[model samples]
Target: MKKLLIILIACVLGSNIGFGQSKTKLKEVIVRPGGQKVVLGTKREKADYGHGGAPNNPKYQTAYFIPAKGASGLIDRVGIYIFQKHSFLEFLKPSNPVYLYLYKADAKDLPGELLVPEPLVIKPKKNTHWYWVDISEYSIALPNDGLFAAVSWPKATKEDNGPYVGMTNECDSCPFYLYHFPSEPRWLKVDERMKKSVEKGNKEKLNQNLMVRLEVSLKK
Candidate 1:
């Protein structure tokens, strides 16, 4: 009986080891040389306007639709060019934080599902030409048809006016984009929103695609 017991114990241990070896392994993805990069949306050669304000305000939020083709990848980082405005200088300081969000687009091409449970917070680096936000650590996966990225600023404080990201009037090859307005109940496409605002002579409500880019690693 003692011998049989010893044999049973050895068999159980061997089975566990075999099971461990048979477990599936995840494929490894490496950041490509020069970093797999994609620039969506449009930015003017000279940005004539800025977007952002308090959280409750009708702030300008930008999103880029990852095309159905070649959308499988790991997002490493993203960056947007911030324009310098004398009127917003205090709000554009390094101390101010910008928030980033990855959302799944809905049927109407509006921001739908929130991809990350917690929003990623980015603080601008000192004197950097571009406000680069690094999120490689999160290992965000780009869904084939539903992925989009957005950025927004928190409410302004008495000490700061709140920073606005720079955007040009140029809209060539720009991806489907939308913006939220303080008065509007939903996100509207830039073209549609601009047209409606123009009809009402509300030119101040107009905006354009932000200067944003994404660095991603294609799945092997």
Candidate 2:
């Protein structure tokens, strides 16, 4: 009887081990009010394909989609907010897609918006000019490049308002740049008064207005 019990326990342990190893990797997504989804990728950047100049307006800020996943480098959300001076501008239209780039935290390239859902809104606010996005209906599996995000927008326009560049701090040492030129955005050189606000932290950060972006991930 003792030998039989030992054999049964060993069989149970082996079966559990095999089951755990064979289970498919499940992917999860987190959504922010602004519609940014951070997922875990395979490869991050894809072939370079773009044309146009950066936006002339100072309020027009660009965003680089940072994927949270690894290989395929798919993105479910693009946070529309960035650290500017001492304020935050949520997108007015939070569900509109825009062309964006994805990279590892170290700045390695990954895939673009290869397969993702569309955004939900696009309304503008007052002080700043970013649109807020709400992505509650779309979601994608995390890829191997580690989770990341991508930028998307309508076909290039001659207008002076929309963004023609996306910025990423994935490379901490270098300053983020616009897709059009090598020069950094002017906001990087915030005025002294605003610098003080950044030091003060979020308490000092205000939402003067809202800009907009797209939503492609969902949560329940």
Candidate 3:
């Protein structure tokens, strides 16, 4: 009985120690209200279009560049304007999850190294307005040169019809760009292209800016 008790206590102590060592420390975070918001991308009142529909669509990715002025702030929130027009049944159904990745721009102003190795997975929310994701606990620091926020959606299966997020046409010279992964990945200056396409009445090449924005607080 004494030997058995000793073994049990030893097992319990070892288990506690292992659990302690595996625990990860979370970062300090504080959520501020909309009034104290500092937006890092093009602010638009409404989105005019939706992108990405079919399975393995090249248009599944979109990105926005952080400006030099806002690069010193600590990112705490990410907001994406989305629209869901499907039936109530489809809306309730589970779909492929969307992921948000932070990447550094290369020499060609393309997405380079991924800053967040473990990309943040976004929970799909049904909303008429902007869907916000709180990421303050991640302690994401805006890079000086600029960082790109890229959102990639999972391939849409036959049974699951995924939701499409809104895209804005408000920013004519917006710093935000859209990424397509058809063959070799490429970044498109969508706003400029859309403006020119509209002027020329070229509907074939028209594209708009993804309604993705970041909220951050500058370090004191």
How does each model score on TM-score? 0.62, 0.31, 0.68
- Candidate ranking under TM-score, highest first, comes to 3, 1, 2
TM-score of 2: 0.31
Steric clashes per prediction:
1, 77, 0
Shift of residue 218 alpha carbon in model 3, Å: 1.3
The TM-score, computed over Cα atoms with residue i paired to residue i, of candidate 1 is: 0.62
lDDT per residue (tens digit) for residues 40-106 in model 1: 3332344545554444442545565544355567776666655533335643545566666778888
Highest lDDT model number:
3
The predictions' CA RMSDs to the true structure, in order, are: 22.2, 22.5, 19.3
Tell me, by TM-score, which candidate is best.
Answer: 3
Better of 1 and 3 by lDDT: 3
Q: Tens-digit lDDT track for model 3 on 24-108?
A: 1222234465434466664566556554433545244567765546347677787765554556876576655667777888887
lDDT of model 3, residue 192: 58
lDDT (10s digit) by residue, model 2, range 1-220: 4344333322221221100011112234544675445343211121111212222322222233333323232233443432121124334333222443333333344233443443322322332223333333344444443333433334323432233222221232222222221232222212234324433433322111111132334223
